[model samples]
Target: MGKKKSKPAPLPQSLALPYTGVESHAHLDLPPFSSDIEEVLKRAKESGVRYICNVFLGHEAWKNNRHLFEQHDEVFFILGTHPSHVDQCTDAELGAMRAAFAEDSRLRGIGEIGLDYYWDHFPRENQKDIFIKQLHLAKELNTRVIIHSRDAAEDTIDVLETEGFVDYPVLWHCFGGDAELAERIVKNGWYLSIPGTVTYPKNEEAREALKVIPLDRMLIETDCPYLTPVPYRGKRNEPAYTVFTAECVAKELGIDTEELWTTCGNNAIRFFGL
Candidate 1:
């Protein structure tokens, strides 16, 4: 008999949940999706992503692509200099960022800005300086703050505490902290955003942290063009895959996916004032 043909696996279902939640953090302005942003957003919409916050890692990126948000009212922006690109930001840029925040209503928050010791490209002191400046900017504007801390949890916590911005609506984006840190973050009335990493089998730490966070304090994100969830790990991530992260978080917390979806959606809406 002739050899039988094997069928390819189907593309994972897009809208895996009933509710279209917000993609609280993403880099839609990055190069990966520069060619097909419309298609990428269309997929996100089909996958139940009602809103998206396109976080800029540096002032230049924000300047070049700020108009992208104008095409869709559902899309918003958070401006800041990421730790890795802290040196790229200048005094004039900082002033411009503040001015932009004041002028634009769609400028929802300040961040994807925090400590990242994982990469040694920029000096630690410089990163901290820029981070503190933006934190103050967030406070001055009375807007939400989205943080990015990797391998620098202690310093991140210290800066947040010392800076006295814990009272602000802060979201620890792409959180990889342990249960202990999760407790501290929630105790301070801050939020923890679960990324696609939660779906990975080896990410017990993220799942463990998720257990300690109350539903009201939990938000789901893809951190897309990166951190693609399991089953789609090797491929480039997009906002559409946020559902898979939400599903994994729901399973971890022992709740219905719909309930999880609604709670996280509400949490994003409240935190970002969307």
Candidate 2:
């Protein structure tokens, strides 16, 4: 008899939560997905990713692509100037961003705004200034904040504290900090987003950090088109790959996958007020 075809394993499922699964951070509006955004979204939906928080790099990017989000109700935005692009932003641009935040109901927070000392392309002072400005704007609008800190953890924490953002809901996206920093973040009531890098063998530090985070205070994301996880490391990442990152985090915490998924999904919803 001919060999029979085998069915693929079922995708892991999470308990019914307010959200379908959440991609806490991504750049879906980038050029990488411009040609096939619909297919990308379809893959995300099939993988159970119902909500995505897209971070806008700058005012021009937001203005040109904000309409793309309007077509997808599940997609949300975090409008702000990324630290790497701080040099390009001007006072007028910042004012426009403030106005957009006030007018756009889809903007859940101000974010992907923080220190990135790894790249010396722009002066550190400029990055900090823009970051603090956005933090103030977030406070003014009563919105949540998403932070992107790379090689500038201590500075990032200091800025947040100095700006009086400690009391507000903050999401430390793509957290690559050590266990100590993770503890400090959770202690301050901030959420740490586990990225696909956790799936990499060399990212043992991130995995250890994940162990210290309580499920309720933990979130998972692909940080798509960047930190593509294992089995797909060399390719472009998309929202659908968030499942792989979630599975890794669940394994690290020694819990069932569904529990991690539900907890993280609910965490995103509550943090973003979705």
Candidate 3:
């Protein structure tokens, strides 16, 4: 496909600059964050962030949020069988995800679910099976997948294509891979979401990969309250802080910050159906 020109759409003054409508991709269920969540969410919305794609790390995390999805217009959740949690679960448990998804239209997609061979917590076969099952769930639900792939690009891509996502939306959240693989994902029409990782000056590979990702297919995230970008690098990350990631991406793309912010905001909205 040809590269599309990065023409920015005009945004309202209130929604302008620094940025609004940022997306945070990660485990939002951690206990430390639960206490100040109302204040945290208020700040996020005030910052112009439209929504969060909170991924539950396991089935246990999934049970607490039946009302959380409905609590905020800007907070959305993804129900999936995480690769890390596969060892603790069974096929029956994974199957229940489909049932839960079927009952709740609020579920925008399936994922933070994919292969992660970097850790040996789950068996290779079990991870593969759960990944494929979740992909199948996405197909059945006619929604996209917020994928998580670490050191398993080939295996992840292989399963995605084989399971049949020729036209489905797949997002590689917190993407930290090479340019070649970045090109491959873009070529296949999958979207890539970057987090604060891009802000680190030492992360040249992520910077290079940013060059290959089309602005239309790129999304910004905090992946927090971890992977906080500079300034907040050592602090807890939240949705409001995702603007730093957009700033980093804008710098790399050689474009104005506001322009890049608008582009990423639109991409996140379109990708997550927010």
Candidate number with greatest lDDT: 1
Worst 10 residues of 2 by lDDT: 10-19
Candidate 3: list runs displaced more than 4 Å: 1-20
TM-score ranking of the models: 1, 2, 3
- Model 1 earns a TM-score of 0.93
Root-mean-square deviation of every model? 2.1, 3.6, 8.2
Q: Per-residue alpha-carbon lDDT of model 2 for 1-274, expressed as tens digits?
A: 9999976433333322223589999998888898998988877877777788888887777888989877799999888888888876688987888888777888888878899998856888888888888888888888888898989999999999888877579999998878999998987779989889998998889898887888888888887789898757788998877887877888887888667877888889888889
lDDT values of the candidates?
0.85, 0.83, 0.77
**Candidate 3, clashing residue pairs?**
20-48, 21-48, 21-49, 21-50
The global Cα lDDT (0 to 1) of model 3 is 0.77
Clashes of each: 0, 0, 4
How do these models rank on lDDT, best leading?
1, 2, 3
lDDT score, residue 247, model 3? 69
Give per-residue CA lDDT, model 1, range 2-82, as digits (tens).
999976423435446654588888999989998999998887777777889889776677778888767799998888888
- Which candidate leads the pack in TM-score? 1
